[model samples]
Target chain A: MRTIRVELGERSYPIHIGSGLLKNIGAYCQEAGFALRSPLLVVSDSTVAPLYLPQVEEALRSQGYQVVTHIFPAGEASKSLAVYEDVMTTAIQGGLDRHSAILALGGGVVGDLAGYVAATYMRGIGFMQIPTTILAHDSSVGGKVAVNHPLAKNMIGAFYQPAMVVYDLDTLLTLPPRQVSSGLAEAIKHGLITDEVFAYWCREHAEELLALDLEALGYALELGCSIKAKVVGNDERENGLRAVLNLGHTIGHAIEAVGGYGVFLHGEAIAIGMAGSALLAAKLGRDRAIYEETVSMLTALSLPIRLPEQYSEDDLMEAMKHDKKFKEGKMTFIIPEAIGSVSIVNDIDEQLVREVLAQLKKEDNPW
Target chain B: MRTIRVELGERSYPIHIGSGLLKNIGAYCQEAGFALRSPLLVVSDSTVAPLYLPQVEEALRSQGYQVVTHIFPAGEASKSLAVYEDVMTTAIQGGLDRHSAILALGGGVVGDLAGYVAATYMRGIGFMQIPTTILAHDSSVGGKVAVNHPLAKNMIGAFYQPAMVVYDLDTLLTLPPRQVSSGLAEAIKHGLITDEVFAYWCREHAEELLALDLEALGYALELGCSIKAKVVGNDERENGLRAVLNLGHTIGHAIEAVGGYGVFLHGEAIAIGMAGSALLAAKLGRDRAIYEETVSMLTALSLPIRLPEQYSEDDLMEAMKHDKKFKEGKMTFIIPEAIGSVSIVNDIDEQLVREVLAQLKKEDNPW
Candidate 1:
């Protein structure tokens, strides 16, 4: 197992990436000195529970944890306040306590939902992320847990760190192809923001990574988590540098929310968001070469660069305008300056934003 | 004005307690380095909004702030998840940004609900508590913000600190008689959990406090806030020393929740909860005199020592069992060891708990 410590003092936890680690999470918890005062409350969803919950339960049970599992129907819709209430109501029924730890044993949605439940329950509780999908590689490490509002995404949440993240690679081997591609978008984002060599490696091994070759996948996931850990460690509350992590999230969230949610995977939305950011940067006199490179990279990876046809420029603009990153009608976009470098640019002209969003759609009929 | 600094390291903020501080909030924020990043989004409820929102808004406006106001229907019902959603949605609509701070301007409900909104909005932004009620002296200072769940009270929340607290005592003059009694319960709690002299002072001045004698009320509120600030500074997350603050909360929350909510004020419930804890502590061979002192103090303040007639022992126990503080079926009770000190005892005999609840109701019919 390759262990990456997140380096958040006292709140620090490890991201353990390896095959077959799911069966040994009990050992990891013990090492973390969880001294768990109550039985484990394993929170998963219908989609993941059928595939992974049994083994996870067995392993935890073997460790003498009298586990209680609460499963909800899986999807982004499950992140709503109604479901959040259901999860908490069920968690309480499952006999969770202040000292009890909640094991979030699913992908991004489950992690966000369950992590939020752990975050707010009893003011907060111990939480561990047992990520079953690659998207969690990014979400699991940041300590950002939230539930979606009907009008916006992640409108309610907290910056609560987990005690550990058990990234069992064996679970990823079962992730559907679409799920894999959806998750790859964020890993690519990590490389684009901070590491040129890693960015180039991602470009060169695009096919290998897409095909889920174990070696490429492991390195990509580990590297993505390491980058996130460092960023979160330095800026736990995202008052400064952590804002860079939301590089494409502004317009991306707008698009995802505009698409009525669950239509585009989180990373898929992130992928398009990164593209919009790049083009906006280019329009604002950022290196044009970097813009083209980012576009080409996203296109090559089969990530959508064009705005979803269903959304109008006005629709996307309205959504983007509501993004939490937007301040007083001025927008902030993190755009790539070079292969791996990015800058947080604010007050991009509204007409320019409208024009760039339109340009994204114009390229839909490429030669 | 007396300034008490809640010493929570870099996240620390000042609690300004005095009469007429409400109209000077703008000056306080500017001096505190708020810089008015965005227009103020002042969150209030129907009752407090009509009573105090205009003055609060006028003060903020004078500070060169563009204010946006959203008022929901008042009372404890407003702290539901449904209302929590409306607050967040309205906040986004009100043009709140990451830099903008939410001004919570009401009693504990407004502080808890609005503080929670600020805590989770954009993964948290700047927040200030403008408590208009004496009960908020406890809720506002601790950084413990939350909304209630159907199964429990304050079941969904966070331990998010505020930028500053503007506790204007003048607002207390217009409060209803019952409101005064409700708010004093927390001030009494602060004393029962820490300083004997404070407890004695509370008893000695009970009539003046209930009568809203400005001088007496000011001392009670300041002392209550000072005690909370110290406990929270020493332990922000209630991990160790902070847990003592919940001394009567376990059964108290149960009583409040079981009483179908809205029936008893938070402070009223806390008063009964404190009495229960004292009796339970006495049952464990602590000083019996402490129990007499607590009951008499609560009675003098017009706080209920009797359990509400509507809830049966089974109902209260069931509610207590679901408390976040309970561990492995053993409830955590903050038993008063003396008038000034309390101990956190877990797994007290269930029979003793039954007798205590029964004992509380016995005094309902005095000879």
Candidate 2:
């Protein structure tokens, strides 16, 4: 087992990476100072619920925790205000209190929604994250929990920290090939904006990581989480360095909304958005080679490397404008100056961005 | 103008109390460090928007702020999830950004809803409070922002602080008599849990305070705010010391939910809950005299001294059980040991609570 700590002063917590960690939740819970806290609310969604809920429930039960499990429908669509309210209602109904903590045991949707519930329930409560996807390897560690607004993805949310994140590699075995690909896309972004060496390594081991080679995927998540930890630790609110972590997310989020949520998976959308960001960077960034490398690596991983035909350049640009991160008429993009380094540029030329979108669409070999 | 600083480390903010302060929002904004942030979003409800919106917008416009104003309907009904979503959707439409700050310009409903939107929007942006009611003098200062869930009031919310709280006593002039009484009920609560002298002063000057006596209401708000500041400063979350501030709010929140929201005003319902707390304290508390005085003071102020006829003892008890504050069938009640001091007792006797409810209903002269 390897432990990586994401530091944010008093809000700091650790991310545990290992196999069969879910079966040993008792030890982890005790180490996280959740000794004898009963009636643990284990929250998951429909897809994840059937796969790993019973194992998690029985594991906690062996530790003598009266676990209350709740399963909402699984999907990005579940990250809505109505669903958020329903989760809180579930917390109240389950008799959760300040002392009784929440254990979110699923992917990003469960982690984000449940962490948010912990953040605001009875003002706040302690929560443990058992992230079930490669996507949550990024989402769960950072404690950026929020629900999506219809007009914008993740428009309403908070920078709430969790007590600990238990990334049980055992759960990864059950994920579909597409889910693995989607999660790895975010892991690739983590490497691009922070570590050039890690980015190249992800390209080198793309097949091994995608095939869920236990050691290779574990190393990728660790590298990804470490870079994110430093970014989150320095700027939890995305004020400065933290914005770099959102490299491909600006266009990524827009297309996802344009794609009507579930049509394009979060990771797939972000992968396409990264392609546009690289194109924007190719024109404005210092290192054209880094931009070329990013495009090549994404293509190698079988991730979408261009905007889909359904979305017009005009529509994608409009979707980007709706992001709150865009100030006035200017949208800030995390321009890759080098493989491991990035630049936050606010004076993004609109004509140049439109041109990049046009060129990205012209590409015939994105997949 | 008197500015009372509510100290909570870096989250500290000022509560500006005076007459006609709303007219000079630019100066207040500068003081709160929002001098040049533009495209200010001024949020309000229908009742307050009609009365004060133009003036506030004009004031910001004079200071060179490109102000955009949004308003919802004026009742407690507007504090629903639907309305909260609508407010965020409005922010998207208005193009609010990280650099842009939200200026909440109304009573508790507006303050709570707008502050919540600001708290969650883009993972938080700066927000100012332009409280326009006597009730707001209490709500705005504490930085507790949330919307109501149908199953529970304030069940889904966050303990987010405001950049500045501008309390213009001039706005209180427009409030109806019931609103004045409703606001004072909270002021009286602040005094009871923290300061005996302030509580006694409330008893002595109930009529003057209710009539919106300029100096009296000003002093009342300042004192109430100071007590709240100290409480909130010490405990940002309602863990231990902070729960005392919710002296009457346990049963208080229940009866409000039982009364179908609009039936009994928040403070009016809290008054009834306070009466129940006092009766419970008379039997279980050491300071019997304090309990008697509280009942008399509430009755003197034209606040409800009994639970409404629609809710039975069983119904009220069931409602109380729903409170997460109560752990393991044991409800924690903030019982006043005297006017100036209170203790958090968790092992609340259920039979005694029932008997007190019975006695409260027996009192005929509630008004």
Candidate 3:
């Protein structure tokens, strides 16, 4: 078992990573200071709920903890205000008190939705992240819980830290190949942003991670969470330094919105956006090797490096304008300085971005 | 102008209380570091919009701050998630960025809804409170922003502070007599919980306050804000001491809920609850003078001391049970120790609460 603490002062909590942690969830709750007298709410999605809800409930109940479970449809569409309201209704009906805690027991979508419920329910309550998918390795740790707006993603949310995050690696054994690749995109992003050795390590061990090798996967998740925890701890509110974490998110969010949030997973969209950022970096006369290396890393993990040809550059640009990162008709991009470091470059030219989009659409891989 | 600072470390902000502060709002925004380049959002209600929105817009525009205004129908009914979503849409449509500021330009409902919008929009933005009602004197300061759920009031919300609170005494001149009494209910609540002298002064100058004497009103508001700021500063999240601020809110909220939130102004219901708290104190073997003094204080300001005959004790109890303050099938009451101090009493007998309700319904007030 490996534990990484997100040092957020009084709001700080730990991320526990290991095998069979699901069976020991009750003990973790006890260790985390959750009250047994208060009813605990377990929020999961349909896909993950059917497979693991019973075990989580049994574990919690065995410790004399009363449990209430709410399961929503499993998809990014579930990350909407409507689903949030439904979950909140279930919480109110379940008679959960301030002392009661909410445990999010699925992937990124479940984690984001449930964390948001905890953020606003009774003006914030105790929240624990139990990430089941590899994509959640990034989202569950940062305290950026939100439900997407109709016009944009994560438009309505809060920076609410969780009490703890319980990551049971055993759950990842069930993920399909596409999901595995999507999740690893974010893990690889962590390596690309701040850890040079780890970035190369990820590309080197791509097969092991995709094969659900618990030792390799666990190490990657821990490193990814640690990188995220450090960035979040230093700048919880994203005043300046925290914007570095949004390296690929500016264009990444635009891709998700243009694709209607269904065609591509969040990590997949971000993977392409990271590729775009590298391309943008080269366009701005940075090291050309940055673009080659980023694409190489993403491709090794079987992550998508190109925007689908069907997604027009104009639509993507329109979507970018609606993003939270777009300010005063100017785009903010987190461009890679090298493989392991990035810089937040604001006021990037629109034409340059369009040129990169055009380059990404070519039939043959072009450098 | 008298300014009282709510000392919340980095989130600390000033409460500016004086006559005609609205015209100087642009300057306050500048002082508070609001950016001219980022568009500002002024959220008002139908009632307050026509009265003051133009002036606020002109004031901001004159200072080179681009302004976007959103007005919802004025009432407690507007504090719903649906309205919150609408405001968020306007925020997104208006191109409100992270640097943009949301100025709440009405009473508690507007402050709460707008503050909640600012709290969650793009995962939180800058917020300012421009209070137009006396009741807002209490609501705007403590940063307890929320939108109500169908099941309960303020069930969904966050503890988000504003950059500054601008209280213009001039706006109160337009308030109807009933609204005046309603607003004073909260101002007087601030006095009742902490300051014996201020509580007595509220009764002594009830005529001037109701008549809208700027001098008396400013002094009263400054004192009330100071008392509230001191309490909220010590405990921001209501971990302990901040619960004292809910001295009259528990029963007050129940009364408001039972009355369907439309029947009684929040302050009026809270006035009765304050009287009830005093009566409960006497029933708990405290000083009988506490009950007499409470009734005298409320009556002096034309505030209701008794629950209407139309309301059933059973319905009120049911409403109380749904209150956020009610925990684990136990009623938590903030019982008055004297005229100016209170204690958080948990696990109070339900029967005693019923007895007080029954006594409150009597034609002749009984201690």
Candidate 4:
């Protein structure tokens, strides 16, 4: 097993990536000083429960853990305050203590919502991520877990790190083609923020990744997680450097909120948001060729590179206003200075954003 | 004005204690680079709302802030999850944002619950405290704000700090007698941990403090806040040294929980818990004399230095199991090692705790 540390000082923890890692949880729990008697709650989504929950439960039991499972709905709609309350009720009835640790086993939604539950339950508790989707490659490492508020997507959440993230590549074989494309947007985002070299790799190996070529997929997950771990370790609270990790997320979340979540996968929304941010960056004179190349690569992977027809520019803009990252009523956008380089911009013109929406709409680009 | 810093790096904020500090909020906001927008929400309880809300609202208005006020039924009952929901609803209706700060202008309950509301509303917004009761001098400064759960007091809360705390001394002149004595338990606790000089002051001036002598009260507030600030600055998350601040709070919380919260004022229950801890410390031979002296001083203040008659040892022990500070089912208690030193311990014998309780009950020294 390879260990990548999401360095958050005392809050720092490891992300373990490899096949069959769940069977070896003894060492991970030992390292975390987990109490032997405290029961473990495994939270998974409906899609993941039938596929991986049994094996995870057995592995934990073999390690002398008393395990219980909680299954949430399988999509973005599950990321709500009501579901958070449900999960908390389960935890309370199960008699969880500070010693109790949560194991989140699913895609980005499960990891995000469960991580948030662990963060606020009893002030905070220990949690681990057993990511079951390719998209979790990004969500597992950043410690940015959240639930969607109706007013804004991910408006209610916290920066809670997991005790360990067990990313077994074996689970990706079951991911839908749409989910695979969504995961690639985040991989592409990792490259957009701090690794132009990785961006080049995705550009060259986009087809191989889609085909689930084991070696290529493993490299992508490791690289994405490594970059995120480094960024989150340095700035756990997203004050400055961590915000760079949100390169596509600002507009991406707006798309998800405006389009109504689950319409397009998280990665897909980010893919389009990245395209929008690129257009905004080009208009602001940051870089034009980088924008074109980024969009070309995402489009090549069958990801949506533009907004859907029904979502108006005004609706998207309104959604952006409710984003947690909004500072002083002005929507702050994280745009790339160049491929592998990102910066936060607050002075972008609103009319330019509207014009880009018109251009994307006139071309009938996928939402 | 006396200033104490809660040293949490970027989350760090100051507590300013003096008369008329509320009148200079604009200056403090400007100095701190707070994005000035209004109206501000002044969250208070029934008791403090009538006593100090008008003056505080006028002060903010004089500084060019459009002030709005929210009041809840006073006491520990106001600190439920339901109250938190009410506060959030008010904030949503009032159009609160990162720029609009919450002024928690009451005792510990208001400061804690309102601070929690600020921490979660729109993710998080800035908050200030204008503490009215004598007990608030400690609560207002340390950033240890929270609401109680049905199972445990302070079971549901966060360690969210305020932007600034304006502890106007003049407000204490009208405080009720029980409130004045209740706040002293914390001041006494500060003396037990890293401040022998202050502890001796409490021992010498218990009567003066009860009488609300201005000089004694000023000294108590400043010294208590200073000790709290130092401990918080060193360990903001209560991972280590900060737990020292929880001296007597373990059983103190148990008393409140077992008695259903309102049976004893927070400080009164803590006074009993302090005696329990003192007995345990004496048995362990860890500064036996100091423990006796501490208990005597608390006794002189007319505080309840023994458990309530209605609560059996089993009830207290069972309640202790659910304390927010418990880990792995082992009860951890903070005990005084000397007049000016404290320790967080999970290694104490349970049988010894029972014996200590029996002895205290039979003696009926105070309560």
What TM-score does chain B alone reach in each candidate, compared with the true chain B?
0.97, 0.96, 0.98, 0.95
Badly placed stretches (over 4 Å) of model 2 are A35-38, A364-367, B35-37, B364-367
- Say which docking band candidate 4 falls in: acceptable
**C-alpha positional error of residue A281 in candidate 2 after TM-score superposition, expressed in Å:** 1.8
Ranking by DockQ: 3, 1, 2, 4
Clashing pairs in 4: A307-A367, A308-A367
lDDT (Cα, tens digit) per residue for candidate 1, span B141-220: 97999988888888889989999999898988989999999888889889999999998999999989988999999889
C-alpha displacement of B347 in model 1, angstroms? 2.7
| TM-score between model 1 and native | 0.96
lDDT tens string, model 3, B263-290?
Answer: 8999898898998898888888999998
DockQ of each: 0.74, 0.66, 0.79, 0.36
**Ranking of models by lDDT:** 3, 1, 2, 4
Candidate 1 on A88-131: residue-level lDDT in tens? 88878877877778889999899999999999987888899999
Q: Quote model 4's TM-score.
A: 0.89
Instruction: Provide the overall lDDT of each model, using Cα atoms, as 2-decimal numbers.
Output: 0.85, 0.83, 0.91, 0.79
Q: Between candidates 1 and 2, which one is better according to DockQ?
A: 1
The fnat scores of all predictions, in order, read 0.84, 0.73, 0.70, 0.38
lDDT of 4 by residue, A1-367 (tens): 6678777777778777887776676556666766668878889989999998888887778888777678988888998867876787677667678778888899989998888878777777888888888889888887777776556677556667787788888889888899999998898899988999999899899999999887888898889999988887888766678888777777788788888898888899888878888877887887688778888889877898867678888988777766666665556788888888888887666677677666665465322
Best by TM-score: 3
Candidate 1 displacement at residue A142 in angstroms = 1.3
Q: For model 4, what is the error of residue A268's alpha carbon versus the real structure, in angstroms, after optimal superposition?
A: 2.0
Model 4, position A233, has a per-residue lDDT of: 80
